[model samples]
Target: MGYSPTHFKSINPYNEEIVCEVPMHTKEEARQIVQNSQEAYINEWINTNYEQRAKLLNAVAKEMKDNLDYYALPMTEEMGKPINEARGEVNKAAWAAEHYASFAEEYLKTEYIESDATESYVQYLPLGVTLGVLPWNAPFWLAFRYLAPALMSGNTCIMKHDSHTPLCALRIVEAFTKVGFPTNVVQNLMVGHSLLEDVIRHEYVMGVSLTGSSKAGAAVGAIAGSEIKPVVLELGGSDPAIILADTQDLEKAADVVVLSRYINAGQSCIAAKRIIVEEPIYEKFIDLLKERFEKLKLGDPKDESTTIGPIARRELVEEMHEQVDKSVAAGARLVLGGQRLDDMQGFFFPVTILADVEPGMVVSCQETFGPIASIIKVKDEEEAIKIANATDYGLGGSVWTGDVEKGKKLASRIVTGQVSINGIVKSDPRLPSGGVKKSGLGKELGPHGIKMFVNTQQVWVGPVKS
Candidate 1:
């Protein structure tokens, strides 16, 4: 009936210091939590009116704003995100909450159908409890992205956050509680990874949403599938940034590409992993990128002046280094930083840039989740599009060109979920975000996201005259 004393420590990636030790919930505790959530969904949340749901969502947003620094600081400490970027993530989460609150009514409105019956319509109804398996990167934003939409659509959620960021997970639950959500409407289950399948298979859980690696997605997808439960996956992406020869300003293009490739030390799933440039401007683009990489200051993430921070974990640093080493061995030229910073105390990897990258190289072909940029040269727009589509992951991509129409046209040809023209690829509350192929299975954000876990029921009445 109670949780065990087992616990896990949240280690600061910058200094390897223990930020906090959190108790892990036992299997029974987790099961009870899920049951409580289900009961709350069936008894209270389902009957809660849309107006009241919108108000609660807005209150959560206000709570996030009121305690922005409190939430942002722990995120940076638990994950290696730069403090400034962490702050931005907090703001983004608040915006998502508010965005859903403002538009849920319109998005979930009933649709009337013309038929022989006297009255017929389709209604969007909640599907009870949803399980969200969240990742550590952008901890707050990723969790809130799904939480806001699910709650606004009248479904309760039980989140199983990454083990490495327990503090961040607890903080989110606290925020919900502060907003005066009904008891058990939103809860956090701090359990080990092995218990995830049990939670997924629980009878009361109707849906599951995950934001993590491709491998994790596959495993969870299989589990959710076996039970005939609906799932939404936002997985890994080796997204490409294509630069055409027709670009008017090379400087602007280079700036956008650099930020997209290296933000959050390049741990993002949608970060520009592959940089495909037209042959005419390849050399110029590489030089500009190199200059930008050199300008980045790798230091403590807590420092506001630091632009680049350490990879989140020690094993990730080794993995990223291995990728760089193997790529160089396979003939990819390292133009800038390619080695880990030995002098630093934590897992600090420098801003690395690789040129002459080819298809078979690890850097070009795989999802390199670090501060490393792979530059692939192509002959023309045809080759650019060809190379961009040559990956298994198709989450997101971007096109850089002077002509907006040309960029949009090229974006249409890219095989991905979403694409941006002359701008960094990012998820917006106004549009649906997710991937095609192996990147992800379902969409998130926008109206589609709020409806992902809802059931569409049809209502009909016969005519009085026979």
Candidate 2:
């Protein structure tokens, strides 16, 4: 099913239906949009003080909250996130706007530094336009992750959202316009991957922020590197959830693992793709996972009762099956699910669990982007830590244990950007989130995030004094 190069077709994953086709912007059109964005930044938005930006951002928050379903249903129809989760995502985006609206001033305030000069300080100033290349999953949340801070910092934005989610992207831009943001302050550039280099290399785009696969990140990073423009990448992840033997509450631990791994049909970049269990409780944990996997309801994402939804694309369904087949052939035992439900329509895959999975297997080393959990049994904490850090990607993970201090220490040893000691790993507006290693570069969603698209200039005043 190939689509026209000049247009993007939004196909619903729940039923394999084509929702709409949005025409891709031509190179010249893209240039004009970027030009307008730059003009807006240099002429109006840059002069708009933080108080004005804050008021507008708060208005956006209220607009989203007032019409939550209006912005959320498109996400469900387009990307197949469950209806309830889709609503929550809108809320998360709104919360992020409120967060930056409240905190951007403090985060970007000039800092006085102790130096030999009479007066020295550092200031954060906006860089003209930032080009955000976002992914299909969590479209609203990811876009706002870059937008809230980038806009609050007095920069205009040009969003290059994934082709699979054009409607969501349009809605996002619509949200900004409804709040009376100046024209072109935030414009959605509907273009294919082939034209991305041109967009990044555009003179108006001073920085780039991307959230996608490692391969995509590498390609974009290379182009941005050549252009010498700042870029922030939030890439792929194969996160692990470690269950130490000393855990007093195995049931709660099991719940956390299942929820983290299965939410959004396990399409999340930070989902618990691997579950590392201490050997003593391996059997019990496997049993818990099997029972929970059986109970999860998979159906229309528009259904309120549905717990899991369809994979965003049919290609993802086949890719996940390939991973499962290879892992099983490599000696990973299939415990609960091992195949897609053929009778079901619209790219449905059950919650699959593989037990006795060892390191170096396809499932262990590769980033599994669907709802298939690989269970690895480790003899001790040392092995668990080793296995957790074994992957090429390190974004986020969780460690469950009764001993808080020991859990914190174990979390420190893991080579990831963030970890939660007895909770599910999630991205919050108040905290920073990103990855290390192949997971990508830079951070998002916190004090550091606002600075990613800004110029950190240092000022010093010196006078000769005897």
Candidate 3:
């Protein structure tokens, strides 16, 4: 392959080796992609009945399931997600496909509205062509979460996946082709951020769906907005996991927090970054978390015995360590690990936990996209709620309490898009997942997600008699 300054190089995060280098799409190539998707949608895909769409989607799901190892192994190699978790992500993406196949017809059916006209109703229609700008953390899962809905709803898509995980992106297109999807119905535009504006501004492109950092979101959002098109952004998050001093268990609560904070080596956008505890049980809960952190095995992601793996990039390692040092300088105590595992081959950072962390500390306020958890002590439930909402992000968070009603009420008070009570925060294909404030602008799953790139057209046949 010819090397260009703008090409994407797939690097294995585990050993910091270049797996492959793929050149990005040129401006002309990107324009052709949009044109092909638009033509496919208007001439073939749009006329396809819901049953046919469902059937094809189901077949794609099966293809992915049958070739699980093919997709899962490369994902682990490229991004350093644990082998088991990588497998789980592939299955979860398959589940999303099956889910949309089972529910798309019902979700997009015509809705009748009572009015003076002879008949008034609303129907959801395809927007022809849409763009998906996804990240590397959960490549397969994020792609399907956006693709399943858009495709099932009759809209063709062009996916601009992260350059760090090009193999995962190419495999997604290959799966659709294996299942007999029409050409260009779901294409991967292998391009870097430099060409994003030209893709979004393409005349044939209708809408945009992005899952990336807040800075990337703002840039994409502005470009899409200038063209007067709809854009859905699932951006960065510093979600809080709040634990109350209730009458029930603390160990279970600690388990949930640890899993949320450390899963994917703390690379998930929705992963819990801030840990808020009621002062009465603050030190005890911190001890429980540190013990669990010490137990996590930090090694090769391909090893079945390893739990936590390396960060996706070497630059991220330095960036995260800087955050930790700044937080410690600002009065937060580094209880456990606070440095990189240099003895390891690749980009590995040990599970770091900080205590006595105030609300405005560097680690507490900024989005730490790695395995560093900031522990904050709040006096009571009121103070806990205050600390949780102090950050600008409104993505996903969790609350722990004995009383279900109290937990639900507390969950409502947290200024985020979705909150869990006595459980870990996660994105489900069955629920609408998004954020508010700086977290993001639109939802990406469930019934709400499918509608993000569609045109809700109103139909009325009327004869007014005065």
Candidate 4:
């Protein structure tokens, strides 16, 4: 444990309650664990077969499902994610584990080609122990994301999760052990920010991947880069969601926008922070989205009836409130929600709507990172295109329209890592997920996600004599 007479306290963000005492990991402990992992990888795990590892993955998924009730409560209690969402996040982690299990053998198969001098082929090899620096927004999913791809690729992982969701972080370690994974492979370090550099700089650490703020991502990438190690970072996104005038359903568009904007209490990096609508249906879209925002149920995360929960930390909630306050002061209208939920603790705020948000307005320019929505109107498809591409972000974007061809065309034109034509941005086992511009380096969570951790080597031999 980290806290002492001299250390810090971890609190429940929902009720202003002191949740637990956190541990500050001394550099020695971090180094020892990293050394242990390095030793473990060399002595016991480096040559582990995919089939055996695959079984463990399947078991991990099953264990998560069987223990869903066990996992959901801590997520709600520690992180204040609504019970439904907390459960959903847990389930997705399980799904990612099993998804990799199902295809890892096939995915890792070596490629062989005929040659005269000898045989030529390529095989996936483990990259030793990986360091996963994850955010609290989707604690379990982020940890499992790195573990799933790393373990299946024959690598071990060490997870350094966000401070706010510490309990969920430990449970991730438990999940693997419960599913029969060896000790120390999926290690969870309960440490302070002061110790981050210690973990990243450890001699045994081979690579790093993080999903968090740009500052943190950049810092970690620098350290890993200086060591000549690769880092895959899924940083913040001011992702755009565009609704076309020609789209068939206005109400449906509004519904999807609300959910996308506020999922995880509006904490998702990829959640559609910018809603750019085509002029013809813009009025209707705004009206419905504004109205719908009023009806969302908020409160106890354990209450399955609740749709939104408190923001994860007091400081984050305060910062988000300030962002909204600035937006409204600078001329954005507070259409739906604009202040704290009068009776809650930690940090609870109203679901806000801001209109008349110009390019530099607080809501328009910044990643609000909360349950606030900003509706930007566009006179035509061309204008919508311009507004969506205005930001430096190119992680994800969505284009909605009844014309599938037009949707596809718009999707192609958007300079992002991925675009969902009529749905939400998602990390799938089949498709590559990540971003193009400032979103960070490379992709994760599919074959691409798995490949990022392995060294792809080609064996070349002279072609057969003709």
Per-residue lDDT of 63 in model 2: 95
Q: What is each predicted model's overall lDDT from 0 to 1?
A: 0.90, 0.92, 0.90, 0.81
Better of 1 and 3 by TM-score: 3
Instruction: Score candidate 2 by lDDT.
Output: 0.92
Best by lDDT: 2
Residue-by-residue lDDT tens digits, candidate 4, 210-300: 8887777788889888889878988888888989989887788788888888788898878888898877787788899988888898887
State candidate 1's TM-score.
0.97
Relative to the unseen true structure, what is the Cα RMSD of model 2?
Answer: 1.0
Q: Residue 299 of model 1: what lDDT?
A: 83
Q: List the residue pairs that clash in candidate 3.
A: none
| lDDT of each residue in 1-466, candidate 1, tens digit only | 0123477577888888888787888899999999999899988999998899989989988898888889999888988789899989999999999999999889989999988778889999999999999998889999989999999999999999888888899899999899899999999988876888999999999999999999999999999999999999999999999999899988998998889877898999999989999999999999999998899888899999988888888888888999999999999999999866888877888899999999789987789998889999999999999999998999999998889998888888999999999888999887899999999999999999988999999989887324
1-466 per-residue lDDT for model 2 (tens digits): 3146988788998788887679999999999999999999888999999999999999998899899999999999998999999999999999999999999999999999988778889999999899999998999999999999999999999999888888899999998899898999999999888888999999888999999999999999999999999999999999999999999999988888899999989999999999999999999999999999899999999989999999888888998899999999999999988777889977788899999999899999999988899999999999999999999998999999989999989989999999999999999988899999999899998898899989999998886222
Sorted by TM-score (best first), the order is 2, 3, 1, 4
Poorest stretch of ten by lDDT in candidate 3: 1-10
Displacement of residue 112 (Cα, Å) in model 3 is 0.4
Q: In candidate 3, how many Å is residue 54 off?
A: 0.9
| TM-score list, all predictions | 0.97, 0.98, 0.98, 0.95
